[model samples]
Target: MTVSVAHGTARLSAVAGATAGDAYVRAREALTAAGLSEDDIVQVVEYVTDPAAGCGEARPAGVTVSTVAVEGLPEPGATVAVEVTAYRGGGERIATGSGVVTVADEIVYVPGILPADLSAGFREQYRSCLEVAGELLKAAGLGLDALVQTTDYTATATRAEYPHCGRPRRELLGGTGADGRPVHPGAAGILVDRPLTEGAMVSLDAIASRRPLRTVNPGWRRYETLTYKPGIAAGNTLFMSGFGALEPATQRAIFDGDLLAQAEYTYAAIAAVLREARLAGNAVVRLVEYVTPAGIADYDKVAEIRAKYFGGPVALTSVVCSALLRPEFLIEVVPTAVFP
Candidate 1:
């Protein structure tokens, strides 16, 4: 489907396959079918359950791609889920752009970091990733202050490690130079069984824009530890924080073990946030689903519930990960939508 934001228009599509390699080819073909050439494509996000899945090789030259490893997918035995987002107009490339690439003045891709030179440790690895992210933003002629949303993938992250995770990000991206203020971006963290990079504890990616941004938070839910808004809207695009099956008032997970129920509740939460932003589910153009090992067995059930929320075709990427922020949460859903 087509999504029109303030800077440009994006066309999104999804391709699936029995194997990662095949899915990569199909994804390219799907992008071609959607009328996007190699250079026209902006970003690709691949979800895989297997660490060996070679998603990087599938990416076209000059396009930024991020592959996330998860616990399971809705398609049984499927190794890769590919989602493509291509922009039709309005963006520029900086002279020294390196790992950070900008698309349509809205999205930025920070390539996953595999710091082979650095000693293996969570703090070191995470710090290195943030360093790279900062370099990327600088290369794109932007800074940490321009970021409106971010996503982090980690091998093993716990509530205790949450602050440690934020420490590096805040140090790098949370301050306004010469203004004495804090830059708060909408953020989401995913705990994967394994990351695409070996010995890497965490990888960071983000979206930034020059357009004005406003945080969107429903009055019902509250966060005790994490430092992220419920959602953020920039121009005509909305970036939602990851949603789980937690009760709005209680902040407790509902349907602890039931995948379908959890999926429904997650969608309900997403819808509520969308409503607060003056948007709806059908406006969504991108969806990312993270499922645990137990939840992977019921992937189809989760898909069935997803179909009930989105009306048109959406670029969907599903992955099976080891666990979530909370043990009881079987699934986490992240969505992006465009408003008129």
Candidate 2:
């Protein structure tokens, strides 16, 4: 079996203007309560409505921090949500720049990548972002081809223009795959409440490895033209993009406005990807469930469906986004796994 990866998350509300520090403390305490230490954390994503509230220097030095600016957290009055990904093999230690990376017993997490030129538009900003990512990974003896997954945070105001990112993305990521097509990384892109930096249009989070990255498709040709892949596998891990219960060939959503039905179809689709990766449900290490406002009513029942597919405890994080890719897509499930 693959070595276990530990995950922890917590959300907390503080007095209106001062939420970041308080929430950060509560999150650390929660992880500690669950038996995780700061050293075990390889990746940390702080979802906050307020960008000014980050822990800054107070954040764990060895962790790669991804800041997520959301409209609001799921918890009422909660200003921040802290999510952590940790490895439990007990050899996690910092090897290079403190905030840039963390090597663990089983994985390497190189998180947030944002352009220093916040004044740059989407294209320039992303170009800068990719440059830094390449530098970081290259220094680690890897390349964009080593990336297994990516998360995108784009300004809500520029959401319509975000697709333009495809041009640059196509140019940078794909190393040399079939037909000269790039073996793109699995990804999830969402609209943030505001810009990441002062005027930055986009920022990103990624996971990579020194091992050769490979695409894991469920025999679907729909992604042949797009820059995103259904899943990417590197080392012993598989990273999947957010998937809803949609007909892969026709691109029609299978279940609309029904969380349970959508959840069923979504998991089945996930099972297909797992099969493509030569893995079982028990290989899953973490999951992030993004739900739309309409899906909240049926959220509780999702657990029952999860238990059916997941053989052991799976680390989880859930967020209620302002919206999903489609009105009918009540929920989108993102799964990451380590092979057994």
Candidate 3:
């Protein structure tokens, strides 16, 4: 069983020792209690302590389940800690995220459905991923255009295989963004290299969107338009998505070899987003830091940089991975913010 806490319109569910059966039952109960249909539940963010149960079960309709692991949660006896966040309309839901500093807006919008059972075949499954994304956007009164960021996780994926896995989804939304075309906000591929279940291939997630706008000296990036939705009025908001820390001349990270340097690049990149949004240093809300092996070595430096740039209260999450998209790029950042 699980306890829930809801305040200021934020709904949170915490359950321990949850099985797939428990999630199903809870979904039914929650909808009934909330005066909403089962369809109202858009996504489930499950923190699985024991992966043996396989992260509970498939997601119900209009719902997508994202799995994560926490050091401790629910209770001592709890093998699994699960939380279900119900979005009435275009609220934000962070789906399966990984990185050093996780920002508020970095949370991807996931529809209600089991990831493994997303579709019948990878081709159809791939299309389904885009279709689900479209639905989530529609619910928020945004179109595929609102899809500003994307992280695709697949098994043994390569540049050659990206077209096959990612092209269909991109085509459905718009087209590829490789050459300054209207691409799907930010798109990148990750190599999972692990076997997953059915309907599960290329697990993807996204950030909430705001209509884009152009600004003169929006106070940040020189040549970028800034647009994003706030979590709450006078509260924190989404900063930017998929900003890299590469040297303009070499098109590589300014501090490629050192983790602390890579961490520095991430902080600097996030600054650009804040500038574009016309936000100040104080308005910076959250951080999602991504680092390769080299960056992991200097984890303490990464923490130090974070303390320097974002001194105020903030939410953060980080991840150490084998590599990032660029060889010379050791670190990257995605940020979210709110204003007082």
On TM-score, the leading prediction is 1
lDDT of 3 at 60: 56
- Top candidate when judged by lDDT against the true structure: 2
lDDT score at residue 217, model 2, on the 0-100 scale: 90
Alpha-carbon local distance difference test for all models: 0.68, 0.71, 0.48
Q: List the candidate 3 regions with Cα displacement exceeding 4 Å.
A: 1-53, 57-64, 68-108, 112-128, 136-142, 155-160, 163-170, 174-189, 195-201, 209-236, 248-250
Lowest-lDDT window of 10 residues in candidate 1? 174-183
**Local accuracy of candidate 1 as per-residue lDDT tens digits, 135-205:** 77777667776677778877554445655766766576553412333335777777876767656667676
lDDT of 2 by residue, 1-340 (tens): 1123423221121122136666667667756665667766667787777777565755677567777776665566777777766554333444544256655543557767778688778888877887777777765667777676777777557767777888888888776543344688888876565555677777888777666667889889998887789987766678898888889899998777789999999999999999988888887877777787788878989989988887776767677666765658888888888775
TM agreement with the true structure for every prediction: 0.85, 0.84, 0.59
- Best first by TM-score, ranked: 1, 2, 3
Tens-digit lDDT string for candidate 3 (257-303): 77676666667666655665566655654444455555555665566
Ranking by lDDT: 2, 1, 3
Which candidate would rank higher by lDDT, 2 or 3?
A: 2
